[model samples]
Target chain A: MPAVVVGPGVASGASPVVSVRQVGFGYDGRPVLKRVSFDVGAGDFVGVVGPNGSGKSTLIDLIDGILQPQQGEVLIAGRATREYRRRDLAREVALVPQSFALDFDLSVREVVEMGAYCRARSGEVRGDAEWTLARLGIAELIERRFTELSGGERQLVVLAQALMQRAGLLLLDEPASALDVSHQLRLFDLLRDLNADGLTVICILHDLNLALHYFSKLLVLSDGELAAFGPPEEVLTPETVEAVYGVRAYMHRHAGRTYLTYSPRLRGERKGRIHVVCGGGTGAGLMRELVDAGWEVSAGVLNALDTDEEAGRELGLRMVVEAPFSPVGDETHTENVALMRTADLVILTDVPVSLGNARNVEAVCTAAREGVRVWAAEGVLAADLAGATGALVESGVELHADTAAMLAALTARDGSQRPA
Target chain B: MIRLGRTSVWPGIVLTAGVFVVCLLMSLAFGPASLPLARIWHLVTAGPVAGDLDSAIFWQIRLPRALLACLVGAELAVAGVIMQDLFLNPLTDPYVTGVSSGAALGATLGIVLHVAQFPWMTVLALAGGFATLGIVWMAARRRGRVNIFILLLAGVTVSYLASAVVTFLMIKAGDDMHAIVYWLMGSFSGRGWTEVELALLAVPLMLIPLFRTREMDILLQGEKRALELGVEVERTKRLLLVTAGVLTAIAVSVSGIIGFVGLVVPHIVRLLVGPGHRGLLPVSLLFGAAMLNVADLMSRTLLMPNEIPVGVVTTFVGAPLFVYLLRRGKA
Candidate 1:
């Protein structure tokens, strides 16, 4: 089929250069994205937002030519993403993925120059990296090692690298997840300026305020499906945000802008004995294993029924689940941990440490020293447990990768115990 | 920590010059022929002294072996540096890509079939290395790109299969076991100038192109990122891999299977210096040349007249360092 160009979200009469028609994506026959279709127009800045794992990264990969859609095609400038040469597509579209591996000491300028890659001919450099750096206002950071840059600065450098190609389409996956307020504003301004200059931008953002104030269009994804599409106010309503993110949110107006505070569907208030440092799919298998093994597994702070918590629910385990995804609250951490002490064995599942739940690793370490079986997972990146598990490891507790191994020792067959 | 200022290439050059002199002196002083320095000098300064058997042995046998060590060592280290760069992995040396394995499998074919007794060793090694590399490259490639995540896994598979073919040949050759395994493990003893001259022909041809492009620095950005930057990512990576394979195949053809010089030397140099292959390559070349000569010296002296395979001696030293580096912050 010829690419369907929609003019609805496009500026007045400007038609979409790239459009999707009833595209569905799944992995290993399990559907994550279903019958999804959206249009990206000329100079349009579309903000695709959803909770984590809502097919945001997957969609970007598909658009970037790293992955092929099993059902429908991703069109660029009315042509299939693959029909054009990989370089040709690169010249037209640029991707700024969130993953950062600054292993080699490539300077910021060198990274930005990498943006002009597809357009660069052998024995010749376009020298467009300078202009790109100048545009991002990171011209001063050009010669500095990329790893030495701050989190906010690194984000800008990556943006410069992505935009230096002068690609018409820019696909950013969660551009401001770890930025401070000032940096987030600066990043948004950069995106807005680029959009105003006739560059089509698609930014994946989690903040509703930024999307409402900055982006001209919004695309909300839920469980890998398109939950809502249109202007920020229309799509940022309590119902849409709640349905997309699975929580109860109140849309309140402040300084002529609508801000949302989402609260999850509350279960009955309870005080129980079970301290758990649980998050991510890292704990999914172990949570089921423990629950099925007949332990009272009450999770300390799970945002909601994540893939892991979903497994917990299937096994009929009573977890002190956090409702932050559905409800915005400061008391969720306190409330969840109140029930943490009731558990006899404090199991520390191997979850990656980030600013999001860095304290969870700490909680396990503290509980383990108080005579809890604090077996750490091997094969976990030290950076993931940078702050929390270090002290526990020093205190004679070993860091292991397999929870099954840890569980086996905790529930040993017969009687051969090591010096714990 | 007195910061060793920046690693000066001048220091490397001077150190390399010093290492060359020491190797020359050691080459002259010891070996099968007990040479006196005065007589060696007299043989060089004066045209063929009356009793210059020691000098002839030194000039004909030791000099070539030492030079061959320089060439093979430099070639293997540079090949390793390039392989690590292409993979964007510091731990992935040349063997991980199955380049050396391919060459060994190739050379072993000729040796087992008695074809290697003639001049078919290079042909077989080149054909085997290139062919296995081709099979590996094809199998590992997905969507016109070398997916190293799977490429490493595929290389392991290729190495396994090729080594099995080699093991099969070793079993069949039975009586030639000493010759087959010794050459396969690699050795540089008793080599002459002709072999050294033959090896010099291949090393410079392969390394010059790599030095010119200086692609390792750019390649570390990533294949997709590098491609986007106007680097013909697929072609450049393939060329780099092929050059490295050819260099390694040449080294294997000369030295047999001198293991870990390609793996540990580049990594050791990188730890001392940094990951910039431009400087790292030259530095590793010197360090590797020095290391192999020293190891060869130890092997010859440790068991007088009955030398161990220089390859086994290196692994004995390298495996410990490999484990040490793995623990020390991936340093």
Candidate 2:
């Protein structure tokens, strides 16, 4: 993996565009944001992500000067935002709100022209309005009613309006929330292009993958406080994600980009340790089920590049591996038996018998003989397990049709170990 | 290459101005004693067509009353546009601040108590209008921002309260109900040079909102968006509400509660030229003036000598058009 540099800000050389100092704010005496502070440099493209009611939108509002912080200060361009006149601050910062419902109809050109209001001496700013509409590539929509445009088109026009203000910092509140996939990409591309032109952008994003893919820096807000703020690769670890969002996450790298997969965390602690013995992709599903169900899981005596091994490593499970196309060596078999010896239960997944690996069924039978509880998948007994499957069941191994039945049997036996 | 034509606003302006002038001329000529267009022109230019009746009716009565209607219509329409933009609600009108109801209450009290005459009654009505607005303003304002929902609710509450008071006074007046009803229904029946002058005085107040046209446009996007765009949202809203209240109060004092012009005229003009107030304001001024002047003419001629109050005629014409607009789902 390429090294991701972690720092105070992305554009470290450039002066900060927005500097929030221990800002605390709330509505109707109930605090929504508490002592949140972060610095956004002049050319930074930062994405703010959090679960619902996490103050992502409140942070944007404070930075945009729509709401004053009850405690601390927000400074734009080295001046306190509260001290700057509204028009002066407007020339420094512009916000493209999520969506606006216009009560009266205004043409796209007219709407965009409003961005130049603070600069214009009168209502007319013909040159600036025309230039902005053309620049945003929506010159064709200049005469169309704003209410009649598609969601993406309307968002683009609103972005055009904000750009026309010529503000140094642009704040967007979930700009892509209502857009289709294609429109979402189009909006991000537009923002990227604008950022390339030296505009600093801070956007609140609900989609974590988009934030990881697009932003140089991520600000993770959880329940109105800053959980983490750093480079995406540094801040978006599985542990941090699970801690802040309460979901189990797995980060994967493909095509030189990182993707995060998430699932609801099981709401309890581990009941006992379990060893899963299988190969040829049969063990992958059982390993995931065991891990999510709060069992300390280990899987092994398999070829190095097996799909199960990959899943084990992704879910951070302990495993023993041997080289592919080779027989299970004595060293690997010994390691698998030692793992089974410590486990409270051993599970054998249905795997077809092969010359390279028939010892997996033997390992389960050996563990059952040693008084370790052994559970065999229903189909394993019918499979041609080199004649070891019959011995495995004859050794007093339990049989389960599926993962659900296995989990139910384990839960019943480990009732005393279950979390309250 | 796509060519940009000059705005398309000028053509609408020209068309509105033409309609206004034609309506004014027709209103001046048609009345209880209908005069020929040529004769009316002569009366204005050549002074009375061999009779004092034509001269008296032309200069002193019809012309002032017609001009007063034009001015009141323009003021009310401009006020409506400002209120609609400030609230960002199409249903909002000039009287949303309870100005008309307050004026009605004052006019009713004056009739029942006999405490004031025409000019004094106008003063009392203006006082009542501002006082009621002040209460609604206080009730709705919080942390220096006017909560639009609260403002609307307070306006409705105060309007109901004022109407209840007016109803109580109307019951006390008993036999004087006809006189109070005529005033309440709103009319330009006896308006003269003074009423026209009063409306002219209020006409300049339209410039307050006109100067803030850009702010109003930004406000139409929604208050929070406007504030983010660097507009002093609270200040702009307060200025617009006060200006609209003052204009509506003045119009109501002179012509009673002339309904619909303040509510419907701006909407019609908006449909015609779009909602950019730079164009909408001026065009609405013309269209509003024309509509009221024509309605006043209808009031005099449709029932002849019986003189249906101009307010009744405006409602008769405006309500159907408003309903049509509602059915069309365009307003």
Candidate 3:
């Protein structure tokens, strides 16, 4: 058969390059992919991500036509994948599997040449074996044995073979799993270059950061079902991640790029609630430790755009904020007092006191006087607080030298509150 | 003329073909009653004149025996290549997969039944071989997938069972025991035009895999990977398995259970050329023919009147060479 010269999605005319319609596949009656439906347009770079056993690899297999769906169908180039001959479908889609049984001693050139097995000699639209290897920057490996190369090099050679097919659509199942950081970056960079040249790529990635950073779109799967699918920023939201992965995660935008940070939810281990009065990034580390140690923490009276406020917001803490560079207003002070009133303990970070933020120290002292446990990091605030520090000592607020001493003092206090 | 470079296999193919031609001529000339090279060439050109002693010796006996050995050797070696690649195990050979043992059982049965005639023994051997292949195939199949490890295990298990049955038949054949023992030892001695004709069927079977060289090369990665690379893995596997089975059955019927040649020729050829089936398959085929005929030539002429079984000759020559190549390969 003559080679089908489809440019990316041209084989389907106006349709998508890949249309997976309600596909369900199972092995030995155990379902792996269930009713999964999606479409990849021409030149789309998509990353498939999910927890282990979430049908990520199985979806790649279905898309590349290695395994047919037991229910519904996968259509490549608008034709049902099973209807096309193996060679013809190969001309349309090429897959780089994670690994293969490679015990045979074959030269790199021979293995790469096998990619052109389906096409006629004259129709080798992708260039020769050496040319393809040269394109991958591994042309010197042409005469080397495949089994003699390193894991990353073998993967690159296999990728070169897949490219030699000149398929419009490429599917990779964790192609970066065995690669080092540098090679992983190189592999994805090459994939992006090929995608820019009108090749549609759908890769199954284990690293969510890489997925968000490299791919134009993300397909999130959970428990053999589609969790979400859209642009990476929209599809991989904190709510979706927490719901699907059962972990608390938040996104922060820095330099126009979003990064996701995750913290495990200690279910049923809710330690007592504590309100931390902090600023200038001092509370960031303490807040993270408290949260990880099962303390339900809230922060208060931080100025807008303060470092601690950013950390608090990134950690998804309930925080009371004042205007930037402005004094803590009476309303915000009242909110901070209300938060401290319900707390089992109140933590005060060592921020240099001034008229603008003096209310935070006052609120901590008031909470301490009202039978709430209060711990403060000792600072020059001992001198700067002046009469306020004296009042704090009189109110029975325990001041520790640093966070370690404070945490130790808190652990020693345990369930009992000492008398003032 | 063999080019040891990475590019073309034409020179390797030409070299092996030349070796085959030399071995075939040498095999025809140096048997029990030796014929001069010039006289042998005249007799071959004269083409089987009647009532001529040298012509009868050349055409009726030596020519057919040599051709039968060459064909059977080529058949077994090609079968070995297919089976080894299909099973994806370097240790696999045609006999280890139970096909040859099953054929041996059928031949043993034919010898015991006093129907050791031309076609009956060959037919029954073929039927037995296919039956074992079907049984092993079923044993390895689960839900529709053929598990290769299980297939190899089943092949070895079935091989043992058939060998056990052949042993029992040998113990039971009191008067016909000598003929059974001689057949079990595997020889191309006294085999003539009829056996050559039967062995000629393997030529087409051997040629079938040449068209599938690309698929076979892809399969070196494995079946699942081959499928992803656009090879119809199951269909190709079925066709190659059947070809190997038929070749083993026909060869076993004509020349009995010859060992070593099938197992070692592929490894030798692979060392000479690379493992690309384009070079590996044809080179192994031609080299197998050359190797076996030389082995046969040595077997018939070694002790003058008393001939050792050709199987012993191959084992003696092949075993040391295989170990040396293996150690050298490790280095």
User: Can you give the TM-score per candidate against the true fold?
Assistant: 0.65, 0.92, 0.91
Query: How well docked is model 1, in DockQ terms?
Result: 0.15
Task: Report the C-alpha lDDT of model 2 over A1-420, residue by residue, as the tens digit.
Answer: 222225766355666799988999999899998888888999889999889998989899889888889999999988988898889988999998977777566778788888887666654576777777777777789878788898889999999899988998999999999999999998898888899998999999989899999988899988888888888888888877887888888888889999998766643466678998888888888788777767888988878778888888887888899997688889999999999999988888777766567787778888899999988888776776477677866887988896567877776866865455
Q: On residues B229-278, what C-alpha lDDT tens digit does candidate 1 reach at each position? A: 43556777777777777787778777788888888887777665556554
Report, for every candidate in turn, its global Cα lDDT versus the true structure.
Answer: 0.70, 0.84, 0.85
Quote the positional error of residue B26 for candidate 3 in Å: 2.9
Highest-lDDT candidate = 3
Q: Best TM-score goes to which candidate?
A: 2
Docking class of 2: medium
C-alpha lDDT of candidate 2 relative to the true structure: 0.84
Model 1 lDDT per residue over A19-96, tens place = 765767889898877777888779778888888988888887777766678888888777887676667878888888
Q: Order the candidates by lDDT, highest first — what do you get?
A: 3, 2, 1
Instruction: Evaluate residue B237 in candidate 3 and report its C-alpha lDDT on the 0 to 100 scale.
Output: 86
> What ranges in model 3 sit over 4 Å off?
A1-13, A121-127, A266-269, A326-331, A350-362, A377-401, A405-420, B1-3, B49-53, B117-119, B138-147
> Can you write out model 3's per-residue Cα lDDT over B115-138, one digit (the tens) per residue?
988788878777778788889889
lDDT at position A223, candidate 2: 83
| Interface RMSD after interface superposition, model 1 | 3.5
Q: B1-331, model 2: which lDDT tens digit per residue? A: 1211226577888889999999999999887788899888788897645458988999988999999999989889999898877777778888888988998888788778786576778878888888888899999988777887898889889999999988888888888788888998889988888888878888779788878877877888788888888899888888888888899999998889888898899887776777787788889889989999999999989977789888889989998987776566543
Better of 1 and 3 by DockQ: 3
